[model samples]
Target: MSQKVREIRLDQIEANPNQPRKLFDETKIADLAASIKANGLMQPITVRPLPRKVGEQGRYMIVAGERRFRAHKHMGAETIRCLAVEMTEDEMAVKAIIENLQRADVTAMEEARAFQSMLDRGYTVAALMKELGLKSRNRVLDRVNLLRLNPEFQTLVEGGNLPPAYACEIATLPAALQVKVIRQVSTGQLKTAEQVRHAVIALREALAQDDIFAAMPAATEKEVAVVNRMEAKVEQIAALAALGFKDNECTIAKKVDPNKVKGMADKLALIRNHLLQMEHALRAAAAQGEILAA
Candidate 1:
Protein backbone atom coordinates (compact mmCIF):
# COMPACT_ATOMS: atom_id res chain seq x y z
CA MET A 1 0.00 0.00 0.00
CA SER A 2 1.30 3.50 -0.90
CA GLN A 3 1.76 5.71 2.17
CA LYS A 4 2.10 9.47 1.81
CA VAL A 5 0.80 12.08 4.24
CA ARG A 6 -1.27 14.61 2.29
CA GLU A 7 -3.23 17.63 3.39
CA ILE A 8 -6.75 17.20 2.05
CA ARG A 9 -9.72 19.53 2.45
CA LEU A 10 -12.09 18.40 5.23
CA ASP A 11 -14.97 18.54 2.77
CA GLN A 12 -13.21 16.22 0.30
CA ILE A 13 -12.84 13.36 2.80
CA GLU A 14 -15.97 11.26 3.39
CA ALA A 15 -16.85 8.66 6.01
CA ASN A 16 -17.14 5.16 4.67
CA PRO A 17 -20.81 4.13 4.56
CA ASN A 18 -19.70 0.54 5.05
CA GLN A 19 -17.82 1.26 8.26
CA PRO A 20 -18.63 -1.36 10.89
CA ARG A 21 -18.61 0.97 13.86
CA LYS A 22 -21.98 2.70 14.05
CA LEU A 23 -21.85 4.51 17.36
CA PHE A 24 -19.74 7.62 17.97
CA ASP A 25 -19.88 9.93 20.98
CA GLU A 26 -20.30 13.48 19.68
CA THR A 27 -19.01 14.92 22.92
CA LYS A 28 -15.89 12.76 22.80
CA ILE A 29 -15.38 13.72 19.16
CA ALA A 30 -15.64 17.38 20.05
CA ASP A 31 -13.13 16.93 22.86
CA LEU A 32 -10.75 15.20 20.49
CA ALA A 33 -11.18 18.03 18.00
CA ALA A 34 -10.26 20.57 20.68
CA SER A 35 -7.17 18.54 21.54
CA ILE A 36 -6.23 18.29 17.88
CA LYS A 37 -6.44 22.06 17.59
CA ALA A 38 -4.10 22.52 20.57
CA ASN A 39 -1.59 19.75 19.78
CA GLY A 40 -2.13 18.97 16.10
CA LEU A 41 -2.92 15.46 14.81
CA MET A 42 -0.38 13.19 16.45
CA GLN A 43 -1.28 10.21 14.25
CA PRO A 44 -2.27 10.11 10.61
CA ILE A 45 -5.61 8.56 9.56
CA THR A 46 -5.88 5.86 6.91
CA VAL A 47 -8.13 6.17 3.85
CA ARG A 48 -8.80 4.33 0.61
CA PRO A 49 -9.93 5.30 -2.88
CA LEU A 50 -13.64 6.10 -3.17
CA PRO A 51 -15.22 3.85 -5.80
CA ARG A 52 -16.59 6.40 -8.25
CA LYS A 53 -18.29 6.04 -11.60
CA VAL A 54 -16.71 7.30 -14.79
CA GLY A 55 -16.59 11.11 -15.18
CA GLU A 56 -17.23 11.57 -11.44
CA GLN A 57 -15.08 13.63 -9.03
CA GLY A 58 -12.41 11.59 -7.28
CA ARG A 59 -13.07 11.22 -3.57
CA TYR A 60 -11.46 9.29 -0.68
CA MET A 61 -13.37 7.24 1.89
CA ILE A 62 -12.13 6.90 5.44
CA VAL A 63 -11.12 3.33 6.22
CA ALA A 64 -10.16 4.35 9.75
CA GLY A 65 -9.79 7.61 11.65
CA GLU A 66 -13.49 8.44 11.61
CA ARG A 67 -13.03 9.99 15.04
CA ARG A 68 -10.26 12.23 13.77
CA PHE A 69 -12.25 13.00 10.64
CA ARG A 70 -15.33 13.94 12.64
CA ALA A 71 -13.19 15.96 15.07
CA HIS A 72 -11.72 17.95 12.21
CA LYS A 73 -15.17 18.66 10.86
CA HIS A 74 -16.45 19.76 14.24
CA MET A 75 -13.40 21.98 14.76
CA GLY A 76 -14.24 23.70 11.45
CA ALA A 77 -10.87 22.82 9.99
CA GLU A 78 -10.53 23.58 6.29
CA THR A 79 -7.93 20.81 5.79
CA ILE A 80 -6.64 17.65 7.50
CA ARG A 81 -3.36 15.80 7.10
CA CYS A 82 -4.09 12.10 6.48
CA LEU A 83 -2.18 9.06 5.28
CA ALA A 84 -3.84 7.98 2.05
CA VAL A 85 -3.23 4.31 1.36
CA GLU A 86 -4.35 1.96 -1.44
CA MET A 87 -6.12 -1.11 -0.10
CA THR A 88 -9.17 -3.29 -0.79
CA GLU A 89 -12.45 -2.63 1.00
CA ASP A 90 -11.91 -5.52 3.41
CA GLU A 91 -8.34 -4.48 4.18
CA MET A 92 -9.44 -0.91 4.80
CA ALA A 93 -12.18 -1.95 7.23
CA VAL A 94 -9.84 -4.19 9.25
CA LYS A 95 -7.04 -1.61 9.30
CA ALA A 96 -9.42 1.16 10.34
CA ILE A 97 -10.79 -0.88 13.25
CA ILE A 98 -7.30 -1.77 14.44
CA GLU A 99 -6.28 1.87 14.27
CA ASN A 100 -9.20 3.12 16.33
CA LEU A 101 -8.74 0.35 18.89
CA GLN A 102 -5.18 1.51 19.56
CA ARG A 103 -6.68 4.31 21.63
CA ALA A 104 -6.61 3.29 25.29
CA ASP A 105 -10.01 4.80 26.00
CA VAL A 106 -12.05 2.70 23.58
CA THR A 107 -14.95 1.11 25.45
CA ALA A 108 -15.41 -2.65 25.75
CA MET A 109 -18.78 -2.45 24.04
CA GLU A 110 -17.22 -0.68 21.07
CA GLU A 111 -14.49 -3.28 20.86
CA ALA A 112 -17.07 -6.05 21.00
CA ARG A 113 -19.09 -4.50 18.22
CA ALA A 114 -15.98 -4.13 16.12
CA PHE A 115 -15.02 -7.75 16.71
CA GLN A 116 -18.51 -8.94 15.86
CA SER A 117 -18.43 -6.91 12.68
CA MET A 118 -15.15 -8.49 11.69
CA LEU A 119 -16.52 -11.94 12.49
CA ASP A 120 -19.55 -11.24 10.35
CA ARG A 121 -17.20 -10.27 7.58
CA GLY A 122 -15.59 -13.76 7.63
CA TYR A 123 -12.67 -13.05 10.00
CA THR A 124 -12.18 -15.82 12.53
CA VAL A 125 -11.70 -15.15 16.23
CA ALA A 126 -8.20 -16.62 16.05
CA ALA A 127 -7.36 -14.24 13.23
CA LEU A 128 -8.75 -11.32 15.18
CA MET A 129 -6.86 -12.37 18.29
CA LYS A 130 -3.62 -12.43 16.34
CA GLU A 131 -4.34 -9.09 14.65
CA LEU A 132 -5.31 -7.39 17.89
CA GLY A 133 -2.50 -8.97 19.97
CA LEU A 134 -5.08 -10.44 22.35
CA LYS A 135 -3.77 -13.37 24.39
CA SER A 136 -6.93 -15.15 25.51
CA ARG A 137 -10.18 -16.22 23.91
CA ASN A 138 -12.02 -15.24 27.08
CA ARG A 139 -10.94 -11.62 26.57
CA VAL A 140 -12.63 -11.61 23.18
CA LEU A 141 -15.56 -13.57 24.58
CA ASP A 142 -16.09 -10.96 27.30
CA ARG A 143 -16.45 -8.15 24.81
CA VAL A 144 -18.77 -10.18 22.56
CA ASN A 145 -20.92 -10.82 25.62
CA LEU A 146 -21.73 -7.10 25.77
CA LEU A 147 -23.75 -7.51 22.59
CA ARG A 148 -26.01 -9.97 24.41
CA LEU A 149 -26.79 -7.42 27.10
CA ASN A 150 -30.23 -5.75 27.13
CA PRO A 151 -30.45 -2.90 24.65
CA GLU A 152 -31.11 -0.37 27.41
CA PHE A 153 -28.02 -1.53 29.27
CA GLN A 154 -26.06 -1.26 26.02
CA THR A 155 -27.34 2.30 25.58
CA LEU A 156 -26.29 3.24 29.11
CA VAL A 157 -22.79 1.86 28.50
CA GLU A 158 -22.41 3.61 25.14
CA GLY A 159 -23.55 6.87 26.74
CA GLY A 160 -20.90 6.46 29.51
CA ASN A 161 -23.64 6.40 32.15
CA LEU A 162 -22.72 2.88 33.31
CA PRO A 163 -19.13 1.80 33.91
CA PRO A 164 -17.95 -1.31 32.04
CA ALA A 165 -17.29 -3.31 35.22
CA TYR A 166 -20.81 -2.56 36.47
CA ALA A 167 -22.21 -3.20 33.04
CA CYS A 168 -20.48 -6.60 32.96
CA GLU A 169 -22.15 -7.51 36.23
CA ILE A 170 -25.51 -6.39 34.86
CA ALA A 171 -24.92 -8.49 31.75
CA THR A 172 -24.67 -11.61 33.92
CA LEU A 173 -28.27 -11.28 35.08
CA PRO A 174 -31.36 -12.56 33.29
CA ALA A 175 -33.01 -10.22 30.79
CA ALA A 176 -35.94 -9.48 33.15
CA LEU A 177 -33.60 -8.80 36.07
CA GLN A 178 -31.39 -6.69 33.81
CA VAL A 179 -34.31 -4.38 33.08
CA LYS A 180 -35.20 -4.16 36.78
CA VAL A 181 -31.61 -3.29 37.73
CA ILE A 182 -31.31 -0.70 34.96
CA ARG A 183 -34.51 0.98 36.13
CA GLN A 184 -33.35 0.98 39.73
CA VAL A 185 -29.97 2.43 38.77
CA SER A 186 -31.46 5.09 36.46
CA THR A 187 -33.99 6.12 39.12
CA GLY A 188 -31.25 6.51 41.75
CA GLN A 189 -32.65 3.70 43.88
CA LEU A 190 -29.25 2.04 43.55
CA LYS A 191 -26.64 4.72 44.04
CA THR A 192 -23.41 2.72 43.94
CA ALA A 193 -21.76 -0.15 42.08
CA GLU A 194 -21.32 -2.06 45.33
CA GLN A 195 -25.05 -1.79 46.00
CA VAL A 196 -25.80 -3.06 42.52
CA ARG A 197 -23.40 -5.96 43.04
CA HIS A 198 -24.99 -6.95 46.35
CA ALA A 199 -28.47 -6.68 44.81
CA VAL A 200 -27.40 -8.93 41.95
CA ILE A 201 -25.93 -11.50 44.34
CA ALA A 202 -29.11 -11.44 46.44
CA LEU A 203 -31.27 -11.88 43.37
CA ARG A 204 -29.22 -14.81 42.11
CA GLU A 205 -29.27 -16.49 45.50
CA ALA A 206 -33.01 -15.88 45.82
CA LEU A 207 -33.57 -17.48 42.45
CA ALA A 208 -31.47 -20.51 43.40
CA GLN A 209 -33.50 -21.09 46.59
CA ASP A 210 -35.84 -19.12 48.77
CA ASP A 211 -34.47 -17.41 51.91
CA ILE A 212 -30.90 -17.23 50.66
CA PHE A 213 -30.08 -14.49 53.16
CA ALA A 214 -30.67 -16.98 55.94
CA ALA A 215 -27.70 -18.99 54.70
CA MET A 216 -25.36 -16.04 54.47
CA PRO A 217 -22.35 -16.47 56.76
CA ALA A 218 -22.70 -14.78 60.10
CA ALA A 219 -20.65 -11.59 60.55
CA THR A 220 -17.03 -12.46 61.34
CA GLU A 221 -15.32 -11.21 64.49
CA LYS A 222 -13.45 -8.54 62.56
CA GLU A 223 -16.64 -7.26 60.94
CA VAL A 224 -18.47 -7.29 64.26
CA ALA A 225 -15.60 -5.41 65.91
CA VAL A 226 -15.62 -2.79 63.18
CA VAL A 227 -19.38 -2.35 63.58
CA ASN A 228 -19.06 -2.02 67.34
CA ARG A 229 -16.37 0.64 67.07
CA MET A 230 -18.50 2.62 64.58
CA GLU A 231 -21.54 2.36 66.83
CA ALA A 232 -19.48 3.50 69.87
CA LYS A 233 -18.29 6.54 67.93
CA VAL A 234 -21.90 7.36 67.05
CA GLU A 235 -22.98 6.93 70.66
CA GLN A 236 -20.22 9.20 71.90
CA ILE A 237 -21.21 11.82 69.36
CA ALA A 238 -24.84 11.49 70.45
CA ALA A 239 -23.93 11.79 74.16
CA LEU A 240 -21.99 14.98 73.45
CA ALA A 241 -25.05 16.32 71.63
CA ALA A 242 -27.22 15.43 74.65
CA LEU A 243 -24.82 17.44 76.83
CA GLY A 244 -26.05 20.61 75.06
CA PHE A 245 -22.98 21.07 72.89
CA LYS A 246 -23.74 22.50 69.45
CA ASP A 247 -23.40 20.09 66.48
CA ASN A 248 -20.14 21.69 65.49
CA GLU A 249 -18.84 21.48 69.08
CA CYS A 250 -19.94 17.86 69.37
CA THR A 251 -18.03 17.06 66.18
CA ILE A 252 -14.94 18.58 67.74
CA ALA A 253 -15.39 16.93 71.19
CA LYS A 254 -14.85 13.40 69.97
CA LYS A 255 -11.59 11.68 70.97
CA VAL A 256 -11.21 10.94 67.27
CA ASP A 257 -11.96 13.96 65.16
CA PRO A 258 -13.82 13.88 61.83
CA ASN A 259 -10.53 13.35 60.08
CA LYS A 260 -9.89 10.27 62.21
CA VAL A 261 -13.36 9.05 61.41
CA LYS A 262 -12.57 9.57 57.76
CA GLY A 263 -9.29 7.67 58.20
CA MET A 264 -11.14 4.75 59.82
CA ALA A 265 -13.62 4.82 56.97
CA ASP A 266 -10.77 4.62 54.50
CA LYS A 267 -9.26 1.71 56.39
CA LEU A 268 -12.60 -0.08 56.37
CA ALA A 269 -12.91 0.52 52.65
CA LEU A 270 -9.46 -1.00 52.09
CA ILE A 271 -10.38 -4.07 54.13
CA ARG A 272 -13.59 -4.49 52.18
CA ASN A 273 -11.77 -4.13 48.88
CA HIS A 274 -9.17 -6.69 49.98
CA LEU A 275 -11.89 -9.13 50.99
CA LEU A 276 -13.51 -8.76 47.59
CA GLN A 277 -10.21 -9.43 45.88
CA MET A 278 -9.70 -12.56 47.97
CA GLU A 279 -13.20 -13.77 47.21
CA HIS A 280 -12.56 -13.42 43.49
CA ALA A 281 -9.23 -15.21 43.78
CA LEU A 282 -10.77 -18.08 45.73
CA ARG A 283 -13.57 -18.42 43.22
CA ALA A 284 -11.09 -18.54 40.37
CA ALA A 285 -9.00 -21.13 42.17
CA ALA A 286 -12.09 -23.21 42.87
CA ALA A 287 -13.17 -23.00 39.24
CA GLN A 288 -9.88 -24.50 38.13
CA GLY A 289 -9.81 -26.96 41.08
CA GLU A 290 -6.19 -26.04 41.63
CA ILE A 291 -4.98 -26.38 45.18
CA LEU A 292 -2.34 -24.04 46.54
CA ALA A 293 0.68 -25.83 47.94
CA ALA A 294 1.01 -23.52 50.91
Candidate 2:
Protein backbone atom coordinates (compact mmCIF):
# COMPACT_ATOMS: atom_id res chain seq x y z
CA MET A 1 0.00 0.00 0.00
CA SER A 2 1.18 3.52 -0.74
CA GLN A 3 1.23 6.57 1.48
CA LYS A 4 1.69 10.22 0.74
CA VAL A 5 5.17 11.73 0.76
CA ARG A 6 6.18 13.00 4.16
CA GLU A 7 9.22 14.39 5.97
CA ILE A 8 10.75 11.98 8.46
CA ARG A 9 13.57 12.41 10.91
CA LEU A 10 16.79 10.99 9.44
CA ASP A 11 17.42 9.25 12.75
CA GLN A 12 14.00 7.61 12.79
CA ILE A 13 14.55 5.61 9.62
CA GLU A 14 16.48 2.33 10.04
CA ALA A 15 18.24 0.13 7.52
CA ASN A 16 16.29 -2.90 6.35
CA PRO A 17 17.88 -5.98 7.83
CA ASN A 18 16.74 -7.93 4.74
CA GLN A 19 18.18 -5.51 2.17
CA PRO A 20 19.52 -7.42 -0.81
CA ARG A 21 22.48 -5.10 -1.38
CA LYS A 22 24.95 -5.84 1.41
CA LEU A 23 27.80 -3.85 -0.12
CA PHE A 24 27.75 -0.15 -0.93
CA ASP A 25 30.37 2.11 -2.45
CA GLU A 26 31.33 4.93 -0.16
CA THR A 27 32.56 7.04 -3.07
CA LYS A 28 29.18 6.83 -4.74
CA ILE A 29 27.47 7.85 -1.54
CA ALA A 30 29.68 10.91 -1.31
CA ASP A 31 28.93 11.76 -4.93
CA LEU A 32 25.25 11.35 -4.28
CA ALA A 33 25.56 13.66 -1.29
CA ALA A 34 27.19 16.27 -3.46
CA SER A 35 24.49 15.92 -6.09
CA ILE A 36 21.69 16.15 -3.56
CA LYS A 37 23.33 19.06 -1.80
CA ALA A 38 23.63 20.99 -5.03
CA ASN A 39 20.44 20.01 -6.86
CA GLY A 40 18.22 19.34 -3.87
CA LEU A 41 16.66 15.88 -3.42
CA MET A 42 15.14 15.03 -6.77
CA GLN A 43 13.54 11.81 -5.60
CA PRO A 44 12.17 10.88 -2.22
CA ILE A 45 13.53 7.73 -0.61
CA THR A 46 11.18 4.74 -0.26
CA VAL A 47 10.66 3.39 3.24
CA ARG A 48 8.44 0.92 5.05
CA PRO A 49 7.12 1.48 8.52
CA LEU A 50 8.39 -1.01 11.05
CA PRO A 51 6.42 -2.47 13.93
CA ARG A 52 6.29 0.06 16.69
CA LYS A 53 6.75 -0.50 20.41
CA VAL A 54 3.98 0.23 22.88
CA GLY A 55 3.19 3.97 23.06
CA GLU A 56 5.89 4.80 20.50
CA GLN A 57 5.64 6.81 17.28
CA GLY A 58 6.04 5.46 13.76
CA ARG A 59 9.52 4.20 12.82
CA TYR A 60 10.62 3.55 9.24
CA MET A 61 13.04 1.20 7.53
CA ILE A 62 14.39 1.79 4.07
CA VAL A 63 13.03 -0.51 1.37
CA ALA A 64 14.98 1.20 -1.42
CA GLY A 65 17.27 4.20 -1.95
CA GLU A 66 19.65 3.36 0.89
CA ARG A 67 22.35 5.35 -0.81
CA ARG A 68 20.11 8.38 -0.83
CA PHE A 69 19.38 7.94 2.87
CA ARG A 70 23.06 7.70 3.64
CA ALA A 71 23.72 10.71 1.48
CA HIS A 72 21.24 12.69 3.54
CA LYS A 73 23.02 11.55 6.68
CA HIS A 74 26.40 12.46 5.28
CA MET A 75 25.24 16.04 4.78
CA GLY A 76 24.02 16.08 8.41
CA ALA A 77 20.42 16.62 7.38
CA GLU A 78 18.05 16.10 10.29
CA THR A 79 15.04 15.12 8.14
CA ILE A 80 14.66 13.61 4.70
CA ARG A 81 11.77 13.19 2.30
CA CYS A 82 10.36 9.65 2.02
CA LEU A 83 7.47 7.65 0.72
CA ALA A 84 6.16 5.65 3.66
CA VAL A 85 4.95 2.34 2.28
CA GLU A 86 3.10 -0.28 4.30
CA MET A 87 4.12 -3.90 3.65
CA THR A 88 4.82 -7.25 5.28
CA GLU A 89 8.41 -8.41 5.73
CA ASP A 90 8.10 -10.82 2.84
CA GLU A 91 6.72 -8.11 0.61
CA MET A 92 9.53 -5.81 1.65
CA ALA A 93 12.12 -8.49 0.87
CA VAL A 94 10.75 -9.13 -2.60
CA LYS A 95 10.38 -5.42 -3.32
CA ALA A 96 13.90 -4.68 -2.20
CA ILE A 97 15.29 -7.45 -4.42
CA ILE A 98 13.36 -6.24 -7.45
CA GLU A 99 14.53 -2.68 -6.92
CA ASN A 100 18.19 -3.59 -6.59
CA LEU A 101 18.10 -6.03 -9.49
CA GLN A 102 16.74 -3.27 -11.68
CA ARG A 103 19.74 -1.06 -11.01
CA ALA A 104 22.38 -0.75 -13.76
CA ASP A 105 25.27 -0.87 -11.26
CA VAL A 106 24.26 -4.13 -9.54
CA THR A 107 27.20 -6.53 -9.77
CA ALA A 108 26.90 -10.08 -11.08
CA MET A 109 27.74 -11.66 -7.73
CA GLU A 110 25.35 -9.34 -5.96
CA GLU A 111 22.62 -10.37 -8.39
CA ALA A 112 23.61 -14.01 -7.84
CA ARG A 113 23.32 -13.84 -4.06
CA ALA A 114 20.03 -12.00 -4.28
CA PHE A 115 18.51 -14.58 -6.63
CA GLN A 116 19.82 -17.35 -4.37
CA SER A 117 18.09 -15.83 -1.37
CA MET A 118 14.85 -15.78 -3.32
CA LEU A 119 15.34 -19.42 -4.28
CA ASP A 120 16.05 -20.24 -0.65
CA ARG A 121 12.60 -18.85 0.12
CA GLY A 122 11.02 -21.33 -2.33
CA TYR A 123 10.64 -19.00 -5.29
CA THR A 124 10.17 -20.85 -8.56
CA VAL A 125 12.12 -19.61 -11.57
CA ALA A 126 8.91 -18.50 -13.20
CA ALA A 127 7.90 -16.65 -10.06
CA LEU A 128 11.27 -14.97 -9.92
CA MET A 129 10.91 -13.82 -13.52
CA LYS A 130 7.50 -12.34 -12.82
CA GLU A 131 8.69 -10.66 -9.65
CA LEU A 132 11.93 -9.35 -11.11
CA GLY A 133 10.74 -8.59 -14.65
CA LEU A 134 13.25 -10.95 -16.22
CA LYS A 135 12.40 -12.54 -19.55
CA SER A 136 14.50 -15.71 -19.31
CA ARG A 137 14.98 -18.31 -16.60
CA ASN A 138 18.51 -18.97 -17.79
CA ARG A 139 19.52 -15.40 -16.97
CA VAL A 140 18.51 -15.83 -13.34
CA LEU A 141 20.01 -19.32 -13.11
CA ASP A 142 23.28 -18.15 -14.63
CA ARG A 143 23.63 -15.41 -12.06
CA VAL A 144 22.90 -17.84 -9.25
CA ASN A 145 25.56 -20.23 -10.53
CA LEU A 146 28.19 -17.51 -10.23
CA LEU A 147 28.02 -18.20 -6.50
CA ARG A 148 29.81 -21.50 -7.14
CA LEU A 149 33.00 -19.65 -8.05
CA ASN A 150 35.55 -18.95 -5.34
CA PRO A 151 34.78 -15.70 -3.55
CA GLU A 152 38.02 -14.09 -4.71
CA PHE A 153 37.16 -14.86 -8.31
CA GLN A 154 33.64 -13.63 -7.74
CA THR A 155 35.15 -10.41 -6.40
CA LEU A 156 37.11 -10.01 -9.61
CA VAL A 157 33.87 -10.52 -11.51
CA GLU A 158 31.97 -8.13 -9.26
CA GLY A 159 34.67 -5.51 -9.57
CA GLY A 160 34.58 -5.78 -13.37
CA ASN A 161 38.23 -6.88 -13.50
CA LEU A 162 37.33 -10.29 -14.93
CA PRO A 163 35.10 -10.95 -17.90
CA PRO A 164 32.15 -13.30 -17.39
CA ALA A 165 33.43 -15.64 -20.09
CA TYR A 166 36.78 -16.09 -18.35
CA ALA A 167 35.05 -16.54 -15.02
CA CYS A 168 32.83 -19.27 -16.46
CA GLU A 169 35.82 -21.23 -17.73
CA ILE A 170 37.68 -20.68 -14.48
CA ALA A 171 34.69 -22.00 -12.56
CA THR A 172 35.09 -25.33 -14.38
CA LEU A 173 38.59 -25.82 -12.93
CA PRO A 174 39.40 -27.32 -9.54
CA ALA A 175 39.58 -24.81 -6.68
CA ALA A 176 43.41 -25.00 -6.55
CA LEU A 177 43.69 -24.51 -10.30
CA GLN A 178 41.11 -21.77 -10.23
CA VAL A 179 43.39 -19.67 -8.04
CA LYS A 180 46.34 -20.11 -10.38
CA VAL A 181 44.24 -19.35 -13.46
CA ILE A 182 42.80 -16.27 -11.75
CA ARG A 183 46.34 -15.07 -11.09
CA GLN A 184 47.09 -15.50 -14.76
CA VAL A 185 44.05 -13.44 -15.54
CA SER A 186 45.07 -10.72 -13.05
CA THR A 187 48.57 -10.60 -14.40
CA GLY A 188 47.28 -10.35 -18.00
CA GLN A 189 49.09 -13.59 -18.90
CA LEU A 190 45.82 -15.28 -19.88
CA LYS A 191 44.22 -12.81 -22.27
CA THR A 192 40.98 -13.24 -24.22
CA ALA A 193 38.04 -15.55 -23.50
CA GLU A 194 39.23 -18.10 -26.03
CA GLN A 195 42.60 -18.49 -24.33
CA VAL A 196 40.99 -19.02 -20.93
CA ARG A 197 38.57 -21.60 -22.33
CA HIS A 198 41.36 -23.48 -24.12
CA ALA A 199 43.48 -23.45 -20.97
CA VAL A 200 40.57 -24.87 -18.95
CA ILE A 201 40.00 -27.64 -21.48
CA ALA A 202 43.72 -28.51 -21.57
CA LEU A 203 43.87 -28.72 -17.77
CA ARG A 204 40.70 -30.82 -17.65
CA GLU A 205 42.06 -33.23 -20.24
CA ALA A 206 45.35 -33.53 -18.36
CA LEU A 207 43.50 -34.28 -15.14
CA ALA A 208 41.39 -36.92 -16.89
CA GLN A 209 44.54 -38.56 -18.23
CA ASP A 210 46.06 -38.53 -14.77
CA ASP A 211 42.96 -40.19 -13.33
CA ILE A 212 42.96 -42.85 -16.03
CA PHE A 213 46.59 -43.80 -15.46
CA ALA A 214 46.29 -43.75 -11.65
CA ALA A 215 43.12 -45.81 -11.24
CA MET A 216 41.45 -46.93 -14.45
CA PRO A 217 41.95 -50.19 -16.25
CA ALA A 218 44.16 -50.33 -19.31
CA ALA A 219 42.50 -49.18 -22.51
CA THR A 220 42.15 -51.50 -25.50
CA GLU A 221 43.49 -50.41 -28.90
CA LYS A 222 39.96 -49.75 -30.12
CA GLU A 223 39.23 -47.59 -27.04
CA VAL A 224 42.44 -45.65 -27.62
CA ALA A 225 41.49 -45.10 -31.27
CA VAL A 226 38.03 -43.88 -30.25
CA VAL A 227 39.57 -41.45 -27.71
CA ASN A 228 41.98 -40.11 -30.30
CA ARG A 229 39.22 -39.69 -32.81
CA MET A 230 37.10 -37.83 -30.29
CA GLU A 231 39.95 -35.50 -29.41
CA ALA A 232 40.59 -34.83 -33.10
CA LYS A 233 36.93 -34.07 -33.64
CA VAL A 234 36.90 -31.61 -30.73
CA GLU A 235 39.97 -29.83 -31.99
CA GLN A 236 38.54 -29.55 -35.48
CA ILE A 237 35.21 -28.22 -34.22
CA ALA A 238 36.88 -25.72 -31.89
CA ALA A 239 39.13 -24.40 -34.64
CA LEU A 240 36.25 -24.04 -37.08
CA ALA A 241 34.09 -22.33 -34.47
CA ALA A 242 36.85 -19.86 -33.63
CA LEU A 243 37.31 -19.02 -37.29
CA GLY A 244 33.57 -18.57 -37.74
CA PHE A 245 33.40 -16.16 -34.79
CA LYS A 246 36.19 -13.97 -36.11
CA ASP A 247 34.87 -14.10 -39.64
CA ASN A 248 31.49 -12.92 -38.42
CA GLU A 249 33.04 -9.65 -37.29
CA CYS A 250 34.72 -8.97 -40.65
CA THR A 251 32.18 -10.42 -43.06
CA ILE A 252 28.59 -9.16 -42.86
CA ALA A 253 29.37 -7.37 -39.59
CA LYS A 254 31.47 -4.75 -41.33
CA LYS A 255 28.37 -3.49 -43.13
CA VAL A 256 29.37 -5.15 -46.37
CA ASP A 257 26.41 -6.69 -48.15
CA PRO A 258 27.47 -9.36 -50.57
CA ASN A 259 24.71 -10.83 -52.63
CA LYS A 260 27.81 -12.01 -54.45
CA VAL A 261 28.02 -15.00 -52.14
CA LYS A 262 24.76 -16.72 -52.83
CA GLY A 263 23.29 -19.22 -50.31
CA MET A 264 25.52 -17.98 -47.48
CA ALA A 265 22.72 -18.21 -44.92
CA ASP A 266 21.73 -21.62 -46.26
CA LYS A 267 25.28 -22.90 -45.81
CA LEU A 268 25.38 -21.75 -42.21
CA ALA A 269 21.98 -23.26 -41.61
CA LEU A 270 23.21 -26.61 -42.87
CA ILE A 271 26.16 -26.45 -40.47
CA ARG A 272 23.81 -25.59 -37.59
CA ASN A 273 21.67 -28.60 -38.38
CA HIS A 274 24.72 -30.86 -38.40
CA LEU A 275 25.87 -29.43 -35.06
CA LEU A 276 22.45 -30.08 -33.57
CA GLN A 277 22.56 -33.67 -34.78
CA MET A 278 25.99 -34.17 -33.24
CA GLU A 279 24.79 -32.76 -29.94
CA HIS A 280 21.79 -35.07 -29.92
CA ALA A 281 23.95 -38.05 -30.68
CA LEU A 282 26.35 -37.23 -27.87
CA ARG A 283 23.51 -36.76 -25.42
CA ALA A 284 21.93 -40.05 -26.44
CA ALA A 285 25.22 -41.85 -25.95
CA ALA A 286 25.64 -40.34 -22.53
CA ALA A 287 22.11 -41.31 -21.57
CA GLN A 288 22.95 -44.90 -22.44
CA GLY A 289 26.13 -44.71 -20.28
CA GLU A 290 28.46 -45.07 -23.27
CA ILE A 291 30.55 -41.88 -23.15
CA LEU A 292 32.61 -42.32 -20.01
CA ALA A 293 36.25 -41.23 -20.05
CA ALA A 294 39.00 -43.84 -20.19
Query: Whose lDDT is greatest here?
Result: 2
Single out the weakest 10-residue window by summed lDDT for candidate 2: 285-294
lDDT of 1 by residue, 1-294 (tens): 777789888777889876646688899999999999999999977777677899977688888788998999899889888888888776876886787678777777778788887788888889989977889987777778778788877888887888776777778778877776677777887788897786667556545543354678888999999989977976885585477455546544366666678877688689679768977865754532321111
Best by TM-score: 2
Can you give the TM-score per candidate against the true fold? Answer: 0.58, 0.67
> Which clashing pairs does model 2 show?
none
TM-score of 2: 0.67
**Tens-digit lDDT track of model 2 for 112-179:** 87888888888898998898888988778778877779987888888888887788778877887687
Q: Which parts of model 1 are misplaced by more than 4 Å?
A: 18-42, 172-174, 183-294
Show model 2 residue runs off by greater than 4 Å. 205-294
Quantify all predictions' global Cα lDDT against the true fold: 0.76, 0.80
Q: Report the CA-based lDDT of candidate 1 relative to the real structure.
A: 0.76
